[model samples]
Target chain A: MTAVSATPTATPQPRNAVIRSARDSLVVAKRNLIRMMRIPEVVIFGLVQPIMFVVLFSYVFGGSMKVGGTTDPGVYREFLMAGIFAQTVTFATAGAGAGIADDMHKGLVDRFRSLPMARGAVLTGRTLADLVQTTLTVIVLAIVALIVGWRVHEGIPKALGGFALLLLLGYAFSWIGALIGLTVRTPEAATSGGLIWLFPLTFISNAFVDSSQMTPWLRHLADWNPFSATVQACRQLFGNPGVSQSPAWPMQHPVWASLIWSIVIIVVFRTLAVRKYRHATS
Target chain B: MTGAIYAEGLVKTFGDVRALDGVDLDVPEGTVLGLLGPNGAGKTTAVRVLTTLLRPDSGKAVVAGVDVLRHPNEVRRLIGLSGQFAAVDEYLTGRENLQMVGQLYQMSGRDAKVRAGELLDQFNLADAADRPAKTYSGGMRRRLDLAAALVVRPPVMFMDEPTTGLDPRNRLGLWDVIQDLVAGGTTLLLTTQYLEEADRLAHDICVIDHGKVIARGTSDQLKARTGGERVEVVVHERERLTEATEVLRGFGKGETKVEDHMRQITVPVTGGAKLLAEVIRELDSRGIEIDDIGLRRPTLDDVFISLTGHVAELKEDAV
Candidate 1:
């Protein structure tokens, strides 16, 4: 029954911009994670697709595909596991784009934009949340991979390092998804826009087959692909059999190339996405 | 003292259409200003500009003493907005939606939870607090969206057609909630196409059309401006409509309008009930048997027609 004062009761002290940005991002991430839990179908569907890929690829292409000059099903399984893990992580881009586009269509993005939070928080939070989901899917896929005779030859630390590189690449690609989401009008459009270019990007790389076996021009392009760099890095760190003998610099030092490519993508795309978030909504 | 919300000469355009064409507005502390307009009158555009969701191509706005263009985040901290569309997350439970809004407003997690529970009860969503918003009825989702806006107890609020799609009962419920907020000294700028809503809730009404404010006044003042009381006569016989119009025009202060379909004749008059009595006598003498006759004050509808040269197009089934 008390009359409210026109003045704010307590103005929150102006904190460091970095700290505020981080705090706001975490709040948004928490919201997305909660929504994901509520509709367990989204997470369950995400897990099902990767598991299906593992089983279908292992049984169908395992014996036919050659890795390091050998057509052994077991060796192909190990080689295929890294590519599948990288593919699983990157494919999360579509979900991220679709989720953001849905939010925009429903006016949820407007609600978030009107708040006193940091401008980049919405996109950063979304990308971070998708990264978590990708990590979970990767863990589950690794278990599924092990059941199909995929093995890590490196020590446990190196194997974990490989997973880290895969996640970083996934996080970077999500920024591109974020940009597409902001540009498109509907969730369906964003999902399609996100995936249309990715098929060629993932397939054209050395994720599924040896780059050296392809034509000279195609091999050069695949060896230098950012996606191929991550896949090759995972193979090196996991001590799998798909290490390339190509003279491409990325193939020679896959780990450093993976780091640089992911960092550049993160920097370029995050800036574009956040800028699009501000302008497109207006 | 200056008003709690103020804007001057705000202009925003999309390609060839000026969504907000040089609009000016001021809402004093603890009062409601209703922005009344028909469809596509830039009510939503004005609200968006004032709420810092869109930057005006020209002019300035201030909310709670902060410059909207220069310090939007600070202005954002002082205001709450419930847009035309219910912006609640469908996947999240009602409680979670409110809590998320509170956290975004920078409240502590525990405090956000406590506030969410309080809003759930106040908005009559206590039973549905744990249910996902997707399962909510249309009215329930609207209540939840309004509850989310009030989470911070902001001093200035903007609601853009908050009850556009609600049934009558739900609309009344929302009106009661809005009245309570204003009673607690909140400054509100509400945009609605319904004149009855503006008359019932606003301290002042601004009639806008084609992105321009045509008239601004208190409800009674606006009705007074439209003109004096009117004598409406519905003739029993369709053939007698012209006769009734002639007789009423003799007693009228202005031109009389006759509708052949309804066999009705309406005219403006000064003397109210006394004039009504005289008109009936005149019509009876002329053998114009009237089925219905009344002296009624000018409604906001009359004001809208007089100012804009058209009736406010109302869709009762918009929900």
Candidate 2:
């Protein structure tokens, strides 16, 4: 084997540590994608679920609910389309978190700690891999949404912009999921916690129904939800006609609210996740 | 770069249990250090500290010239670790696993692939390179894991019970692989329950029990420390087992016992090979014809049982 270093001894690697760290993390993410690709069934499941959700909610549920006194109306699809997009992306975040828990259980992440890689790479790589996955899922779900009469009212650039927003929104959720995976000892708990957050946050928000038409308390909660901020952002970006005109702080521009919420959630949850990781390993 | 690795007064408390009790280690370059310990013996805790996986709250450690506590990332770059478990992802093909590791060390795509293929062939996983690692047998998984650790060729390597589940044939095969690595100028710190492994692989062995190194010396030195010649007498009849045991009892004053499972009588004799011949002659005179009579030095097992009151515990706590 040819040694890369020409010197008699290898020395300390002090300069460009972060660049090397990020490069290493990119390798980790690519490996994850390869692993995910190996289980074609899992990839198929991840792809199919969002489309099924779009059909179930937009067609089946859309016919039953009346908005503006018109049952069997098409406006509900437009109203809930962006919200559904957000929900689909949210569902994909569990992959990042569950992957971490599996790696931990298998002792892979612990092995990385003994190597010259960045401490955050394990979590960061999972998040980055999920960003790509969530993007792919978004593109596929978008096609399915189009099949179900869900059209983007915005121009091509704005629609592209909307796609990027949904992905960032997914990445934020992925960070939370990564923490969940790192903190939770078992895969079962990691999965259940993801579900516990998903069902309520997705359902209780305006993703399924109009928040204004719900009970005063439920409406207030949904109005303030992070998912709602995301959905509101999606509505503006997609140029959807039924976009709510809520002027809640950081909500007027759904884009900024979603971005801020994603950043805040990433910071708070990652700090907790890193702490849990340090605790469990030591 | 002075001592290859230094761990001083390493202390770790897991809630109420003190896993490591102020353990201290100093290892020089270009040598293999065998850490022999029973289950929960804190050998792993020390490895975790020196490898920068876990922080030692009260102690300072340096690995390959870098302080592990203050500069973990630098220490990380200089060390390679193959853990107790084969931690490679099952879904990845063996080749992909190696490639991923190479890339993790910042090797370019072409360089990483070349290194990955070389390791695949070196570890004899080339034929199975494209197959997912889940399909590899236990021995193959272990070999691939070791190969992955060598992707960047770090100066220091830590193997924690690397051959616990491997069969005898595969275990020997892995021993050869480790020997080659160490012979090629890699400094290794390996922990194992197999006394034969330490005897074969480690130049100097550290016998640790209850979170402390009770003894550290060369294989011969350790065996001589627990000085005694061991006799294994294989006889024809099962009842003769007891007869050989009784006769051998007369030869050694320390301890004499029947190894019913292997059909041999074992006794600790201060007398060397000359006494072995005398014992055989006495058994023959007493009409106890033997199939085989073998005399050997005490193993690390004996030194451990003498010092710690326990056998090696590599299997019990394996991940």
Best by TM-score: 1
Best by DockQ: 1
Q: List per-candidate RMSD values in Å.
A: 2.8, 3.7
Question: Chain B TM per candidate, please?
Answer: 0.91, 0.86
lDDT per residue (tens digit) for residues B1-319 in model 1: 4588889999988888887889999888889999998888888888888888888999889888788999999888888999788999998999999988888888877888999999999999999999999999999999999998888889889999999989999999999999999998889999998899999999999998877898999999999998888888899999877777778888889988888898888898888787788888887877778789999888899899999999898433221
Q: What's the true lDDT of residue B138 in model 1?
A: 92
Task: List DockQ for all candidates.
Answer: 0.48, 0.44
